[model samples]
Target chain A: MEKNKIRSDHPLDAMLRTDRIPHIWCPGCGIGTAFSACMVAMQASGINLDKTVMVSGIGCSGRGAGYTRLDSYHTTHGRAIPFASGMKLANPELNVVVFSGDGDLFAIGGNHFIHAARRNMDITVICVNNLIYGMTGGQAAATTPCLAKTTTTPLGNPDPPFSLPLLAFASGATYVARWTILHTRDLTKSIEEALNRRGFSFIEVLAPCPTGYGRKNKERSLDTLKIYQERTVIKNGAHPMDAVMDFGNSITLGKFVDHDRPTFSDNYDRTCRPHFA
Target chain B: MKPAVLTGEHFMTGDVACAEGALAAGCLFFGGYPITPATEIAEHMASRLPDVCGTFVQMEDEIAAMASILGASCAGVKSMTATSGPGFSLIMENLGLGICTETPCVVVNVQRAGPSTGLPTLGAQGDMMQARWGSHGHYEIIALAPASPQELFYTTITAFNLSETYRIPVLVMTDEVTGHLSERVVIPEAGAIKLRHRPAPKGRKDRFKAFQPGPNGVAPMAIAGDGYGIHVTGLTHDERGYPGMNVETQIEMMHRLTQKIRNNLDDIIRTESYRLEDAEIVIVSYGISARSSLAAVDEARAQGIKAGLFRLITVWPFPEQQIQKLAEKVRGFVTVEINLGQIHLEVQRCAGSRVPAVLVGHPGGAVITPEQIVDTLKTAF
Candidate 1:
């Protein structure tokens, strides 16, 4: 009998620790999709795997570093950016990437994220915004939409959500972009571009937490994806301030900031090289 | 080119001496936030690190500084951070993470008085007990106290070496007096300074377990970006370094974490005895208070009292055995510290009901005078 023609192997198998999977992601969670996009982007970037390190904070999305078959660190909550920055600055040859959730990155780690960007630290930060804290349960997050129902926000979320692209841009990120899980190819390409960028590059991927955010909102995975498809408008060169996310309104997606500037290490070397000499 | 270690005798504060010691130990990364008493150490490091091709990062907060050092260490470089009492409290959560991950790093807490930032510029040993039990978990720690600038210089190097050797975070618990007091410190040649590095795993990289113990019960470390593809987590993990939440796994992990330091207590614990052989009254002290205790002991000796000083060089493993043994020989024990009865409780616990233990301590803002310690010594009898 002839063997089946379809290939069973996955392209990301070599880049992942297969023994640790099936992963801890919920059945309909979009973090898996975002994580896969990142893996494929790293592969496409053609960077040295041995010289690449992934750092993550405490959350469901933080598990990306553990699953990746690379030099990775699972750091304390809200600390992945600084940890990755240390790796990048200590040895400039290492390719450092921080993968964590919006709650971890924006709430507790917000200062680190903004400061690193302002300093133009040479690192890639891939933040998966699931609108809620998935790992600790369906709690309200810094990225949760206004009027959204969460465990912490039982009645309704009164606080306005952060415009991640605007924050990254305002904080001096040399490269900034936003995408959703529905736009897999664009998200993958953006990550690849961010990986090759010279300064602090940030890509915020809006993902669905079906078990946490979706369960409370009474929306399924497909419904969330449909919302992304219907609301997101691609505006590559639009001003960052105009890219705010209002769940009922339009959500702008695409690279909002791309500029050339001296990174933290480059400036340090320029200023301190004479002293060393 | 400027040398990493400045050889010869020079007058410097304990904070500067500690920075020099870190440089001499080949610490390539210094990540810290500026807190009073400890801020001088960070300032000194900022100026010196770049000269020696080292990295100095002023992290946004103490927690981030702690996390940054752990990351740099995991990247296979010796790393450290310095802070004060409030900052130390901020670092406790990540300090536990560093312990659970078995990352090698040094945390220097140049203590100030605090229930909540009581006195930032004054001297206090208020963090002694907190250094031992600050992080919310059950794990053995190595902490050293330096009474003088000279001791600070040497103890900082020892702190780095012990952290690397044990694959755990080591604490250098200094006080405001020791940290700011300027004194002469002798620096040796870099070649003569002893250093220890984290050993690499000896097995195949693919099959290597990140937390599997070697002969010393410390798992050989594989640095980040070394192609080991290892996963490290703060949660209780097995030998493979994967998170395992069951009771059995928790027991095994906790035992290994505690046993590594407990089993090797002989090598880790250090204490200095000044005329302790034939003394009836013993003063148990550390940090700046140890100096005052020494003066009091000498005055007592001149007046014909059988008094001696037991200075704690390594405060954490408590030196319980030596204290227990000394309790059997001495009539009473007095602990002199800046805070109110921190280490005195430990002395009392060790001395038990057989011999009485007294405390010679103050609130903060001032060091305990020799007269106060002498009064306590006289009253103890």
Candidate 2:
């Protein structure tokens, strides 16, 4: 039966390296869904795909740069923002996108994130928030929920988590939004919107790590998605400060902030490039 | 665009000269942080890069500065960064990343005294060994040591050209004294200065292999928007630039990275010799210390001592052959430098039992004087 079966082309074959199809992403992992949503947004948006480049830091989601059929870079851990900024600044015609996980973007790469947003560097940053450091045996992460069980938090997580959207908005990101991987349609549309925007755009996609986080949390992958379906409340155009992710309560999911200001390139050209002939 | 070269003689500090050298070499992007001694390089670049329609970004820290230059280089621009010892330590991992990914760029280290900010205002050659082995793995690196502001200008240009030719980060290891010293630097006509550019990718984009080596062992580089869709990573990769996790791929990649440098020793390594014919004593040095060593060699020659100067222009790839040849003819060797014997150790190792290799060394904070070398030379004999 296997030998007789005819081959079929996947919809994303053009954007993906299908020969490397057996990706390291585990079954029931939400990272694959989040990655798929990003690809869909890339296609749906009208940007020239040839001019697009993907950059990733070290982690499970960092593999996104390696899988994409585009000019891509997998930089050192927590360095994707600066790396992406360099590429964008060097060639303003190229579209630079940074794709990585929570531990990478929020913890180690936190300083770069805030500074890039403060300068309003023209780039898109998609962060997959799995709550725990999934690649390193489910250690507690900056986004890990309070009282969540993980390897580092043997008893429970004692520290409060960072509100990623609030942080992005406060750091001067022009576009800020959040959605679960289960909210594929909303996530894809939001990513497309961010991609087309001019200033620093950040999209936080809450993903489930069944093997890494779920096993220790006493929840299965299906249960996590079911929780998202039942617990999430969509509230578009809400203040980004109000966007919350308290698993004990209803999760706030929506586009939180959208505005515009002069980007770094625009400011540089105006102030520094007097001889920009 | 503004002409990159100034095309005249100007009195400038070594740091400023290094910046002009970068401009002459066609470096379009400079991403660096502000650290003492090296901060002038960043400041000069920040002010001058705009004139050429290029970009100069002061990153959040040294790590980001390193990352930014690597990114800029991979995007088809000759890029660079400058820092001191503390910053250099922070940039080590990204330096390794540049090596692993075969990105062409330059890193200028205006080295100062350190173990931990030992003396920010003082000069030292303590990083001579660190420049060779600081980046965590066993890989070959090219480092040039310049003795004066004038030499720094030429060395910086040579650094960029070498990096482009060999797909590796070249280090301009200038000292605090050289960086701060002012001297006359003749910037020739832009056309007179030679430049080297990275190989450009050609053929069908679909069939193009990003890491597939040319006859020179350097693969053609493709930047973003080139439509070649190259994947670059710090992970071990194959000729196609895809990650290969196994040992065979690691062996192939490591061998390729090291051999790319090893095979081109002639083109990569450089040195300067002064009054060596029919001499029995050799005084070896580089950078700031080499300045006094030149004076010492001449003074010794005047004093009826048959001494010669062997100044190291390119410090790493060690110049083992030159030392071996010199050891065979010279009665003894004298290495002078700041920092307690860094490259002196290299001289000692290379000279072996053929002759005694004595170090005229200091432990940071002060310059090694020609008189001190004269004293050591008189005593060692």
Candidate 3:
């Protein structure tokens, strides 16, 4: 009862594993900010918190599911979406959420993301786009910049980064958005909106991996936040094609897509279960 | 307009029977990828699961399929996925995850020849040993090899039952011969068929340890949305299911994950003995080879040679005790399989110096005929 009182006063406490507090994310990391925003959204979403399950793949940001007090799953690398998709399909009433980093969601798990979006499965996916693989040290990721120095790309990356919003929109993500940790209120609101909506909703939050990406790039955590604040523009209804991220140039951030077709379950129920219906 | 049970005699393929068995076992979710020989199981599930309001998802690949089934199982659904060798190889990564998380799901591997997509259309018992040690790490697992369509039907349900009972993934290691061959399968009434649901969490929901082993070292699983607010991970952790990175945590976690199956080997391991009471030569086999072994045993007996069949129904946690006892009584043993000598190695290990274990096996393209086994036993053993 006393613990309940303390948690009620701190709304987000109820949605966190207080015992598992003091998470593994390093200080000055933007993941903590983005994660806080997510917790706030889930706490205030008004949906059945008891029924919501969080799933994460392997990465530093993949630990999101571990800290949450909901029925959470920290699945294998690149399997969070599929795992959560399985949960949503098994029981359509339950709210399934996938929370992980870009390397997990976009690179290794890229196929699942596109297919799940195409099927329009009702699950909210939050991708922490730190532009590098943080968990496995400062490695070059699929979202790594064309010329970024990292452990693997000490000579500078020859590959281009993916425009995640463009990918999500092209892959049929019903609700697409991009925000940074600085835009916590918007990120929270976007998550809250995705929580209430149906279909495969995706939000890519550009967070700073100070220890991984930042250390090699010569950008301190503060400098990274400064870039997010100054170098990014929020164009709420802009075309996803323009929602690119090239830290040197301007980055576009906003809710890029919000429309729904028949979800996988909707199609399943419509095409199947005649006598049961 | 078929019900999930379809409780009657139906002359169908083994794949169809396996699907029906899953439905009868109350498997509410199936996520799978379509591969040869195993494709029929997915097709059968696609047509049947919807009729029963069960979730059927054809995932992009075997990895996604394996991962999805684990997800559904975590949500309190009896889930399954089916595949062949190529697809089975892809499922290995998440299979480890399922093991570490102690997720209860059924994975059916309709064995075909493979190093990498070796013989797609042919039946092979080559994956029997793969079913034992394919996943990374040394963790105990339950795998059943059914010889016929009828046995496939019962074995699948038994797979799910053991999976739920032990809170671990069970493999229905049927081959393309057993999976594709059409045979008479009598589906018992729903009430008659046994089912094992995972024990539910007890006591206060807030303090529930998600990985705490209950009566039989199997933890009570609380599904998502049940308000138990449990956390499950593929990382090494304690009963609370948090990531505990240390030697002690690894030792404790590995013990619980593995010992659950090891301690209950008597319950988890199952086999069939035929004419072994007064026999001298014992023929050990599983899956399609077991069918041939049974015939070989009969043929050997008719020829005035004392031979009996020791058919391994549950191949993994390899029936050591029974094999050891047989080795003590029998003069020599013939380990018949489709692989070069996978289960034959296990047979040799169990048989020891008391009896010699000979392999009646080949790199599989076709089923090992009864004549081949009979010839092997007549000469080799």
Candidate 4:
């Protein structure tokens, strides 16, 4: 199937299965870039692609599951975490990954996010922070940076944005990282690291929604990628406390935290063993 | 004729037996909150599931408990959740999702009083109607009522089987009294039990469509990330699984969903007829109330009255044809229930104009006594 296809000049073309192409992504969408990074990361990690189950919630980013020519599920909005948690417990051998948008993961599913992290379930959550709701036509999202213009936030958003990596860290995720689309290799490495991690791993990739959010904020097309790359700084020996100062404009984008905690299922199995026996 | 084997044994209440029945059904995962009489079932599952390498999680609330079980079921496990009226009410929305998504699982409702926090520990069968149409939208459901703990255990197994066989949610609707009652239920050996499995779609890679129904109208369910084109949504979906957004598609989807159970009603509905052979007075009942009706039948027969009991094992599909045929021979029908008579209406509908069907109602925590049923029967006669 790979040898027969006419490869487009797009760098992502090599990683994507061409037959499943004519992708659902809109023109100038950074989701495609994120998708490319995800594919590269999966390919690089040497994890069993066949055993990898992708669970996604409702949103533009949720469609990532449908595009991946692997075993994936497009679940109900904001409900992918529980489903992914179940899959991991059912088959500890299988790799479970949740791909969701900012709105899907943080706003509506915020409660689930914290608890799943707190329990340290063995799963990877790759949150695509687009700053606004893209599928529903540029509504202000939980991560829509304050003063950023959206259809819902025409005069600019009054609500403050969420620092996703710090939130995950506080919620007890064993691994937390952030990256932008421009740093393709960095984003891939973060995803690779999250997948290989044994406990709940969360990665927030600042993906540009060139059509809705990007156009409204006056940073449309691939130019948004350049802006993100220039504005974000990679921090070495960074603690989650550092994220507090960089909230407004400058953002820290790198492997922010990586540690260990007993996963929910592992602890549950241990606690329940004596009773079942 | 051989002498009749008169074995009338009274044992512990129904609720205790229900707990034992769940253990017998091989239920390993139970996610529920403690609500009234239903709490015993949860307590039992909590204590027992671990012993069998099963899981029991008392979620923060009933909504999560219901949703979590649906998730666990998708992960290829037999799971259940137990609750009363309030908790059951909270689960209605997800129950509808369970129907549309075709997730196989069980919900045990130990009936309690009222619209809101009725009688907390009290008994009432008010949830009878909720079990059928409590969930939003139009979809079919399979419900069962156990008159004994033996039936509770057996019905739970049957509930699991029906859920798996049809790929739909099954409700084990036990009233507060039955949920609390205990009895000597014979646990069948593992080999003697028949476990139903749906048609599993083969070929791990992309050839599988998760919602595609087989010849039996039950589509094979694959765990998420099984490397298949598995797109499940709460929306009206086509066989290919992308959203179908058309009137024709909606109509076709509803028809298939409704017909899957309606067409298989014969195999799905089960009931028991006691002394129905030559009886002129028939009392139809189910759940805990059936025990009272059974006693009423015997008392009426002792008084030279031609009386019998028709106990419903499968409550939702409502053994219509059998009741319609029985109505031909019976002079009158008495429907006894714990609620202000829900299943009685179903019996009345099935009985048609063939006989006068009267309801002996008790819309409270107390069980409908056999004397009350006998009085109604005598008055009708």
Strongest candidate by lDDT: 2
Per-residue lDDT of A101 in model 3: 95
Cα error of candidate 4 at position B65, Å = 2.8
Q: lDDT per prediction? A: 0.91, 0.92, 0.90, 0.79
Clashing pairs in 2: none
Put down candidate 1 lDDT per residue, B209-302, tens digits, no spaces.
9998889888899888788888888878899888787999999999889888988988899899998999999999999999999999999888
TM-score of 3: 0.98
The two-chain DockQ for each candidate, comma-separated, is 0.72, 0.86, 0.84, 0.40
User: Candidate 1's error at A18, in angstroms?
Assistant: 0.9
Give the Å error, residue A35, model 4: 2.9
Per-residue lDDT tens digits for candidate 1, residues A3-119, read 767776778899998888889999889999999999999999999989999899989999888898987888888999888887787778899999999999999999999999999
Which parts of model 3 have CA positions greater than 4 angstroms off? A1-11
Kindly provide the TM-score obtained by chain B of candidate 1 when compared with the true chain B.
0.99
lDDT of 3 by residue, B1-381 (tens): 777799888999999999999999999899999899899999989999987889889999999999999999988899999999999999989989888888899999999988788999998888877788888888888899999999889999999999999888999999998999999999888899988888888899878899999878888998888999888998899999988999898999988988898889988888889999989898898888888889888998999889998889988888898898888878989989998999899899998998888999989888888898888778885
Error of model 4, residue A192, in angstroms: 0.9
Residue B248 of model 1 has an lDDT of: 92
Candidate 3 lDDT, tens digit per residue, A91-187?
A: 8879998999999998899999999999999999999989899988889999999999999999999998888888889988899999999989999
Question: Candidates' TM-scores?
Answer: 0.98, 0.98, 0.98, 0.87
Candidate 3, residue A92: the lDDT equals: 81
Q: What TM value does model 2 have?
A: 0.98
